[model samples]
Target: EPEVTQTPSHQVTQMGQEVILRCVPISNHLYFYWYRQILGQKVEFLVSFYNNEISEKSEIFDDQFSVERPDGSNFTLKIRSTKLEDSAMYFCASHNARGGTGELFFGEGSRLTVL
Candidate 1:
């Protein structure tokens, strides 16, 4: 079976620096999403992309954040600046266009740590 894949499983950056997390979902999937977990907190949705545009976004996706499907296969999330509070496990997910309310297959996650 195929699955979502993320690069640089772990990232450590200084406060105020920028970071970009990358992901590759199954080729046949139609929806892409980004979610984050702050340590023990529940996973929170950041944004959802469909048809190459943002379909939905949460308050967490402020001006300082952005997502792009630079190429047909790769999806990326860029953060203009980092803060200690930004440290979390970022997960990349995707869902097929078939019959279903909404079901996502997620990546292992890219852990970001800000110092």
Candidate 2:
């Protein structure tokens, strides 16, 4: 089965550097989302995108964050400036349709660590 994939399974960065977390979503999915889990916290939705524009974004997706489908197969999230609070497991997910209560397929995650 096709699956989502993320790069650099772990990332170590300073407190205020830019980081681009990369993801390759499932080839045929229409909806893509970014979610983060702060260590032991529940997974929180950050943003969702479809048709090349943002469909919805949570308050957690502040000015420092942006997302794009750089090409047919690549989706990326860029943090303009990272903070210690931004350190979390960023998971990329995709669904074939948004209307149904289908389960999302997630990548193992790109773990971000900021010091």
RMSD of every candidate to native, in Å, equals 1.0, 1.5
lDDT of each: 0.95, 0.95
Best candidate according to TM-score: 1
lDDT (Cα, tens digit) per residue for candidate 2, span 74-94: 999999999999999999999
Assess candidate 2 and give its lDDT.
0.95
User: Compared with the true structure, what per-residue lDDT tens digits does model 1 show for residues 2-32?
Assistant: 9999987999999999999999998889999
Model 2: what TM-score?
0.95
- For model 1, the superposed segments whose C-alpha errors exceed 4 Å read none
- The worst-scoring run of ten residues by lDDT in candidate 1 lies at 96-105
TM-scores of the models, in the order given: 0.96, 0.95
Clashing pairs in 1: none
Task: List the pairs of residues colliding in candidate 2.
Answer: none
